[model samples]
Target: MSVDVPRRIVIFRHAKADWSQESDHERPLAERGRRDAPAAGRWLASAGIAPELTLCSSAVRTRETWKLAVHELPQRPRTVYEDRMYEASLGELIALVNETAEDVNELLLVGHNPGMHALADALAGDAEGDALARMNRAGFPTAAIAVLTFQGTWKSVEHGVGRLTAYWSPQE
Candidate 1:
């Protein structure tokens, strides 16, 4: 028999970056980004949800963001550094998620924007609310976290199938 397992996806854009660096991939987090990372962690911890696996981009800012926030998790989760995620398109990200093991009920992805922003909106389905609308308009700013929940395995996830459960940011 097929069993239904609820999957929770926690997606966050890397914290604010230090653009003064010469290379985009090597650019570090700005001072405010540094401060916001742990705040994002604490925000997730406050919600009493911890990821089972975390996928992070290899880019410096994303790595730094994951490092700072991951410390706040109640227990350490397995983390993978994915080079593709650094410049991944939304479709690429989705493909990665589809390959996830079924045992992982909750997963976190820390990456960059435009793709991240587009993914969040595309996956949120028909979810309607002032908060989601507000978030959608903001272009998924740095350190923003969006949570989605759905009853299915990662591979089963399709466009607009997940429901936007919660959305938060350091500014909130």
Candidate 2:
């Protein structure tokens, strides 16, 4: 894609996780999560928000969520399960996003919060409709996604450089 082309980023929080697992990384999704994840995917598909690349946390919950959600998409994108994203901070997440290849115009991040939530808020210098307010009011709950649009190369992605174009959640 050209440097001037608009790029989209969907920051997604993994679905609700089962707390019974002793290891956090190995925790699977709860029943509600399974239900919500597919809904999130259908919403993405219906909204025509397909990413060219997907960066997912290496946690079991995230993996499971992606497995369910991706099946609803018309096409599958390149997906990477990154270990560092399990508990990444906002800065760390931004750095990871900056490393995205310039050719990929749309990127998806399936991870945790408050990093996902913080990234959405930080990148969005402005918002459309009541997306910002809804996101804030919802507190970025599980299976939630924030859609941001920005211009320039991935390396230039930074705070206040994007517009929050949309926000969605299972409850909504």
Candidate 3:
């Protein structure tokens, strides 16, 4: 990959889950989440942010969200469901990104919060405008998406090197 090429990482928080289930991993998406996931996917597709690869958490809610969302994409990306991503730490997520193949430029990660939120905050050094400001005001919520762009290969992707191009939530 050329140094001039920019890699984009799209981080997505899984949609609202059905809390009636006892197992965290087993919990499925709520009724609202089922409807919202496709909207987020369409938004990304319409914005020309189609990913070349998707890393999804093994949790039921995350898996279901990915299932519903990809239908709205312009193209189907290679996807993997991993158990580690269910509640991965920022470092773990960074490591995963670093390990991405050089050819893959746009990567979408569907996982849970706290780690995803921290990862976005750590990687994004600068913001365009109200995207970062709004995130600071409301915080990352269900079905929210954060887009980070940086001029480098996946191997070079690092903390505080990304530019937060956009942030969106289903509530909006």
Candidate 4:
């Protein structure tokens, strides 16, 4: 992709997970999460936000969310199950994004909060209408996805470099 072309980043928080599991990383999605996951996928499809690559956390809940969400897309993008993303800090998450290949125009990150929320807030220096406000109000709930656009190579992605174009939640 040309450096002049805007790159889109879809920051997706994993769906609500079942709390009964002994291991946090092994917990599966709850019934509501199962339903909400597909809704998020449908929204992405309707908005035509097809990512070229997806960097997903290896946690079972996040992986399950990706499985359901990707099913709604026109084509399945390349996906990497990254264990580091399970509970990555904002800086670590940024580093992961920076390592993205230049050829990928759009990238999706399936992970958890508050890293996901922090990344979205930090990157969006500006917003389209009330996108940022609504995101704040929603508190980046489970299965929420924030769409951001920035102009530059993935290596250049940093704080205040992106515009928050859209935000969506299962309740919405």
Clashes of each: 0, 0, 0, 0
**16 in model 3: Cα distance from truth in Å?**
0.4
Tens digit of per-residue lDDT, candidate 4, span 113-153: 99999999999999999999999998999999999999999
- Candidate 2 lands at a TM-score of 0.98
| Candidate rank order under lDDT | 4, 2, 3, 1
Model 3 lowest lDDT segment of ten: 130-139
The estimated TM-scores of all candidates read 0.95, 0.98, 0.96, 0.97
> What overall lDDT, based on C-alpha atoms, would model 3 receive against the true structure?
0.90
Off by over 4 Å in 2: none
Per-residue CA lDDT of model 2 for 49-78, tens digit only, reads 889999999999999999999999999999
Off by more than 4 A, model 1? 1-3
> Model 4 compared with the native: what TM-score?
0.97
Which lDDT tens digits does candidate 3 get at residues 1-172? 5887888999999988988746998999999999999999998888788899999999999999999999999799999998889789999999988989988889999999998888888998998888888776668889999999999888787889899999989887
CA shift at 105, candidate 2, in angstroms? 0.3
Clashes of 4: 0
Winner on TM-score (2 vs 3): 2
RMSD of 1: 1.4
